[model samples]
Target chain A: MNGILLAMILALLIPIYEAWQDEDIWQKMLAFASIATKTSIMILVVSVLRDDWMIGLVGVLILSVGNAALMLLAHIIRRLNEA
Target chain B: MLENLDVVAIAALLPLTACMLVTQVDPYHALIIRGILGAVAALVYALFGAADVALTEALVGTMLSITLYAIAVRSSMSLRLGTLATAAPNLDAAVPSALGQQLFPALRQAIKKHHLRLEVLPYASPQALQFALENKEIHAVCVPAEQLATTQGTDDVAAPYLLNVRIPRLYETLAAALPPELVAVSFSRALRLTSAAPPPPDSQLQNALEG
Candidate 1:
């Protein structure tokens, strides 16, 4: 269980590194979305380990709503660029 | 065997490595990498028995973000510019100081100010330009100021700005951005002005009719 948790922690590092390296606005936004998803997944994993549905609920909410809003924002920005 | 920590560690490592490599790629490829990152994360969540989280990641992170990024990339602003061939000297030159040189800065200003994607094309003669305009091949045309003067009595010559009638709003935007001395003439008037010249041999319409 500890090893699985450690792996989850390590998994979170990728998006951080990607956001740091990428310069384009779209790529950066994508990296942030990745980070958000990973973080929510980590939350869910931790909640499952503790058998706490409350934290898991939070994770599910983030997973469902967070990236959708972010992508919508991206679309708006893209339309602005087109205009 | 499936519960072994080593297996889980390896699974997580694969995705982590993929995410790291994603940052090294160009923007276009980076988009794909980002999708992969989301998928791998979802897979990791599933392995850890976080089914809800995994499903969310797959839908939002992989599908939604990728679609949005694709739309953003696709929606980049584009403008097509047609110029008299002789007016546009060798653009390949290290420092081109031709008649079209002055226009470049204006175009650049418009792009930088509005984040526009512009393409510059050249026409061999006025007739070819007219044909191209009629076929909706270009958005705007730039002829030499002198050419406009010589074509006097034909129609109003805007000296540099002749916009397509299809996009009246573009005329306002371009007129405001371009030099004041440059006037904006309608497509029909511009066509009539150029009609004084003979037609070119190589156009899609002509090619189809001849062939």
Candidate 2:
């Protein structure tokens, strides 16, 4: 368990570094969506381990809905860049 | 199991690393990194047995705020224009400094006409002025009109032809209003110019440069 936690923490740095290196706005948005997905998955994993359905449901909500707003923003930025 | 606790500990550390990384990146990049940081925070909250807080972070911190930042970044651009004013005005003083006497009024008019949120930054010397522009610290440098004709002949100043990024179309407009002696050189072109040769001569930017 301790090892998994360590790996997960280390994994977060990957996206941060990706965002840091890229200048394109779309790529940055994609990195953010990836972060949201990873977080939701982590939450779900923890809830399952703890045998907590309530926590799992919240995780599910984030997993499904969090990216919707980001997609909209990405679209908006794309349109703005086009115009 | 003991293994699960270990996993949670490792998972808990990811967001903290992300939190630090977010600050180091540019504001545009931060917009994206912030979302990931939000998600990592949520997972940490869940690992700590706070599902509710985690969910809120996922929604508010990751989703909502990223959108807000995107909107801000998309609609407007911040410009740092170098100026002669070393400091803010001193109303107590009987006479305004030369920077006040010359630059401010014209800049104020340009800001209103062009709808720019102009910030006047002071540089210690010409080398510092050029360094700041080269490093992308400031958007442009506002030099006295006469300085444009003299310094512009050199390779250093000639590189960009001094076009403003925010108002690419304003070169002609500015030329008319400001004294024929003063000119606003656009520093934003450094990146674009470095990648390619000067733009076509007929281009508006070229017109600004020729003057």
Q: TM-score for the first chain of model 1?
A: 0.86
Best-fitting candidate, scored by DockQ:
2
Give the least accurate 10-residue stretch of model 1 chain A, judged by summed lDDT.
A74-83
Report the CAPRI category for model 2.
acceptable
* TM-scores of chain B, in order: 0.50, 0.38
Task: List TM-scores for all candidates, in order.
Answer: 0.46, 0.51
Residue pairs in candidate 1 whose N, alpha carbon or C atoms collide under 3 angstroms: none
Error of 1 at A82 (Å): 18
What is each candidate's fraction of native interface contacts (fnat)?
A: 0.00, 0.81
Residues B94-207, model 1: lDDT tens digits:
222333466666766765555566666677677787778778887776554334434443354434344343356666677677664544444342453443432221342367
Candidate 1: how many backbone clashes?
0
lDDT of 1 at B69: 76
All models, RMSD in angstroms: 12.6, 14.8
Candidate 1's error at B9, in angstroms? 26
